[model samples]
Target: MNAVAHNAQSVINAAGSTLEFLSFTLGKEEYGISIQKVQELRGYDTVTRIANAPEFIKGVVNLRGIIVPIIDMRIKFKLGTPSYDQFTVVVILHLENHVVGMVVDSVSDVITLTPEQIKPPPEMNSALATDYLLGLGTVDERMLILIDIEKLMSGADMGLAERSPA
Candidate 1:
């Protein structure tokens, strides 16, 4: 076989049924989302405040001519008073129609895990709804709360339901 064919086979075998997640921190816990949905990462910056927008909606920022809405997950989850220090970051996500940016405490490295490593999210009563969670990912000593970024961003609480603010 040629070198290119050999390399392709190696990658396919190594990646067998594995999924990648972009891990990030919120408050004191770690969370993750599908890496394929992530467009890019940027440092937290000032946003234009919108009238009647939800508190969690920190407003919007222009990303390459696109008005991308920024949501502070800390505020949405009621973690605590969010602090925008140097470590604060904005995770740019590419949904079906809109490109949204999520403000996270800090971003960690990407994690790769197989289907077996991903366990069902435990039943619990909390600010984070189970419908927004994909599952719990376990990688060695770390536990990542995998979330459905697309669904969460499109939820009613995200100020993108169906009615425009009047």
Candidate 2:
């Protein structure tokens, strides 16, 4: 077989099994979430804080006239106090019939990960338990904490339906 034919077979052998991760940084660590769930990326905008809302919630913002809840991912992950600055961005995610925004320090880029590239969570306990993490991606010298955004930002704890503030 020619070299091209051999390469084609190799590619086919790795089919149906790759996941793309949207990578971003929180503090000094790199993290990733499945790209399929992300809707869009918006610059850091002024948010209207809701009274009697959870602390992790950044607030509500008018996303093109549609009200969307903004969540501080750093707070959700219990990393540290979140700061709003030039690098801060709101990443809109769609999950389970709800559209919400997640705040991140900075966005790196979208990365493709095959099953082989993903690794299990660390045996020791982390600030974030394994339940919140999908897995870990070890690429070169960097470690990407794979986060399940839907599970992390599910409106369940946010009490979204109980209050309507616009």
Candidate 3:
């Protein structure tokens, strides 16, 4: 093969191999979710409260014509009481058959991680459920807790949806 043909093949191979994560903060720690699931970002706004719902489940919001349930990640992770500040934002997620919104302290940016950059989750009993954790992604000196957003959102404890994800 010609040198240019080899380089072109290399670029094509590399382009689709990387996965993107939308990085956000809950407190001091950083977390990431699949960028493919993210629909859009919106500033913190009032949500209609759901009676007798979990504290972490902030409530529901009318996004366009669809009602989306907003879950506060900070509260769910037990980081601390969340304050609706300028930095507070909600990430609209497009899950199977429905839409959900996740609230975080602030959104950093979308980061792409190669397969080599992602390490398997530690084999230790931790506060956060290991099942929902994707792994640790290293970018430069920063470590991001990559989360399986779909699994976490669709878990039995979530109570946000009736039908289980297939």
> Distance from true position, residue 160, model 3, in Å?
2.0
Clashes of each: 0, 0, 0
Question: Best to worst by lDDT, what's the order?
Answer: 3, 1, 2
The model with the greatest TM-score is 3
Rank candidates, TM-score, best first: 3, 1, 2
Candidate 2 TM-score, true structure as reference: 0.80
**lDDT of all predictions, in order shown?**
0.82, 0.76, 0.83
After superposition of all CA atoms, the RMSD between model 3 and the true structure is 8.2
Candidate 3 Cα misplacement greater than 4 A, ranges: 1-16, 126-128, 163-166
Per-residue lDDT over 32-65 for candidate 1, one digit per residue giving the tens place of the 0 to 100 score: 9989889999999999999988899999999998
Greater-TM-score candidate between 1 and 3: 3
Per-model TM against the reference: 0.84, 0.80, 0.86
- Candidate 3 residue-wise lDDT at 163: 49
Candidate 2 vs candidate 3: the lDDT winner is 3
**C-alpha lDDT of candidate 2 relative to the true structure:** 0.76
